[model samples]
Target: MTALSDAEFVVRTVADTACANEEYFGQLDAVVGDGDFGYSLARGFEHVLAQWDDFDRTDAGVFLQKVAQAISQRVGGTSGPIWGTAFLRAGGKLKGHETIAPADVVVALRAAVEGIQARGQAQLGEKTLLDSLVPAIDTFEAETAAGASTDDALAAMAVTARTTADATKELQAMRGRASYTGERSIGSVDAGATAVAVMLEKLAGAWPQR
Candidate 1:
């Protein structure tokens, strides 16, 4: 069973990372977007942190649902709905479970991915977060099935995220505001994808303990 504490730690890590790298994410987005990506994410997650203790602890699903509420209500533009949907779907997948298992982890992640796709109307190679996120989750599932320790799985995920995020430089922006930049978006790394890499790297350093 995955401890509630562990889930809390991961969510908190994601929020902190988003807040800390606000400028960096904005810079990435500035290459092809309006440059508000970082600011939006940071503000949304800050609200999540502010409401941390008030979140329902009925189960992992309910807890994440509360998180989704906070983000959707606080964040602006497209980011709020997309990011909130991810947590909400993940939480839904784990609903009723006071704890999560490795298999549950897989399903929850898959659900989150699906939610992102539906909400963002994005697919792979779109030069979005999914570019990194999908590959990283694939690595995560493989490592878990191989009986890797949590640290090992997280390590692989970090590497995959960083690698895939960088690889987005080779793909044209096919979605989001970046798509409006046309061929000009091809040369820059995706802001959302890089953010995913950063978040995974943060998790790699702190997993096992949480």
Candidate 2:
């Protein structure tokens, strides 16, 4: 598929998966938060799906920028700005590219990670999604650099995402609502981290079908 089509497929899958797992995500968040993460994510992604066809499709970057607007405007709470920033930064990284290469994905993601860090004022090992996401991105980039196929790189990413997400249990919350819980948040996983892992796993699983 063309890069635009691939981007579309990934965005669609991400929205659909988030919407589908709302309750599960909420439960994860409820462990240490007010359980709003899932609702925020699902609502934002639902807007993306609801207006999917109306989005500008000039290129992957433009499409993602449009979706970022939807997510920023529609999603409630802190999640809106954080996730919207991620999408917006990625879009900015890919701006003006008619067709993207594998390396482009890494560049865009690196931008997204930076955006999330800036917007959320968080970093790796903060018991946030970054804890899992950063490592997963690193693994993907390393695998691709080592001459692995996209599929293999993505599969490794999924594995890293899952393990690192679960590993958040060993971390103390230093960001987000979970931070308010102090030591109480140590045992539970971060909902955002798990959600990232689940999304990557779902993407890896559906990639072959695509």
lDDT of 2 by residue, 1-210 (tens): 877788898899899999999999999999989998999999999999999999998888988999899999999988999999999999988877878777999999999999999999998888999998999999999999999988888899999999999999999999888899999999988899999999999999998889
RMSD of each: 1.1, 0.8
TM of each candidate vs. truth:
0.97, 0.98
Model 2 regions lying over 4 Å from their true place: none
As for candidate 2, its clashing pairs are none
lDDT of 2: 0.92
In angstroms, what RMSD does candidate 2 have relative to the true structure?
Answer: 0.8
Worst 10-residue lDDT window for candidate 1 reads 1-10
lDDT of 1 by residue, 1-210 (tens): 354666788899999999999999999999889999999999999999999999998877888889999999999999999999999999988778866767788899899999999998999988999999999999999999999977898899999999999999999999888999899998899999999999999989888666
lDDT (C-alpha, whole model) for all candidates? 0.92, 0.92
